[model samples]
Target: MNIQTVGVIGAGVMGIGVAQNLAQTDHQVILIDISEDILDKAKYEIRNNIRLQSFFQKSDNRKTPDSILEKIDFSTSYKLLENADFVVENVTEKWDIKKGIYPQLDAICPQHCVFAANTSAIPITRLASLTKRPDQVLGIHFMNPVPMKPMVEMIRGYHTSETTIEIAKQMLSQMGKECVIVNDSPGFVSNRVLMLTINEAVFLLQDQVATAEDVDKIFKGCFGHKMGPLETADLIGLDTILFSIEVLYENFNDSKYRPCPLLKKMVDAGLYGRKNGQGFFVYQ
Candidate 1:
């Protein structure tokens, strides 16, 4: 179960982050996506993240931008994915889309290759059910801005074998990341707890408790949180946060997990956070 090459199937933030991290470890990566344009964009995003990390860490002065760029192999063909030691699906959060990928990947990949999803909310058990090799499938969820975030959630599905989970954990830890194993649960651990706190913050905002700036200042000043919920939402994307809350609400049927209306309105208005240059607070 020792991983050598990785195939990342998606070109968005999560997919690119996983690819970049793997690459920085000098592991070969086949970054698959729908089209060239998307892959190009993802490559740029990964480069930008690396550049920022270089400035902030200010330790590794040897790894230049060009050096980091050499680690990825972008491809539009699924053929490149067949030889991957692990294939990580980080596509949009849709059951049918992920379900469709498993059988196809299973048919092509080596029998021993492990399959994992970067799904922030979908249960790993459900995704495992759709695959011919259910035992190989599990959840390896990474937070956004992957290089900076050291935590990774390794979720064990009903069908996922112990061997696969262990291998996944070892690989993540080998990359100098921390791993916390969780039994397949809705929103796993971090999302479940984080969403509740964020929902309350949204409620206060809705009730006019204070301005966004005031809320962030008070939370950081009093509780010692580096970033408040509202500010983090802006950075992560309001739409992304809302989607996680919706998943939680449906799975637990808890009104507390219900997304704030203000969150919805901003999403509806297309204020998707830093990417869109606007959200709870204006960016740029």
Candidate 2:
């Protein structure tokens, strides 16, 4: 289906970015957050993402970013989502919370509106089953820093229809993202492999094999990696990194996929990479 209006549930980092991108493409975007405070914060984030792309950077293009920001309609009310042609649910990683929104989305959205989850690792099939229109539900996983990231991982669940998959690709491509299709699995591909590498880096730090900075340096210095695991985990959110590692471990039952204690402690303490001002390096 041709997507003219987009509904975004949750106005967190990922949600706003998704809204911003769609809005830039001139799609009327409804960005919903349950709490007014969270919705307010998301509005701030969307503005920043737009400013950085439009005016802050010397090398960045300005046109599309401003237009994208202009197209968004931020709200705390779920009723605003009714007219959307596509719904991009980007709530927190908790399964129950994500599951709760789908049925509600199903009730409100147009019967043919595409349901796309911006989930990083959860099996889409489980989430899809909760909705009435399972055939149209699919995963459209955008990487972190959505405005800057170029890739969008399109994950198809066990029962995802061919039409849903095609529409997902078309929507993301229309917004200028590189869409790669992957089966519903833990961490899909890039994140799964990257999690292992990051977990190993964490292991080295915990085992006293290297300092966090050096752990990052070794990979960048010798392994041709531009961003090391710890640095990456920080940017990806230590909470997200830990959760992805856990999912990978649980899915594979592999010792190597186990998350580091340091990772857990940081997340538990609420230090989420750049967002928290501390993960590996100080952000501020």
- Most accurate candidate by TM-score: 1
List candidate 1 segments past 4 Å from native. Answer: none
| Best of the candidates, lDDT | 1
lDDT of 1 by residue, 152-266 (tens): 8889999899889887887787677998889998889888888787778888889999888888889899999999888888876787788888888888998888899988888
How does each model score on TM-score? 0.94, 0.92
Tens digits of lDDT, candidate 2, 147-226: 67888889888889998888887888878888888898877887778888888887788899889999988889998988
CA lDDT for candidate 2: 0.82
Candidate 1, clashing residue pairs?
none
Clashes of each: 0, 2
Error of 2 at 72 (Å): 1.4
The Cα error of candidate 1 at residue 69, in Å, is: 2.1
lDDT for predicted candidate 1 compared with the true structure: 0.84
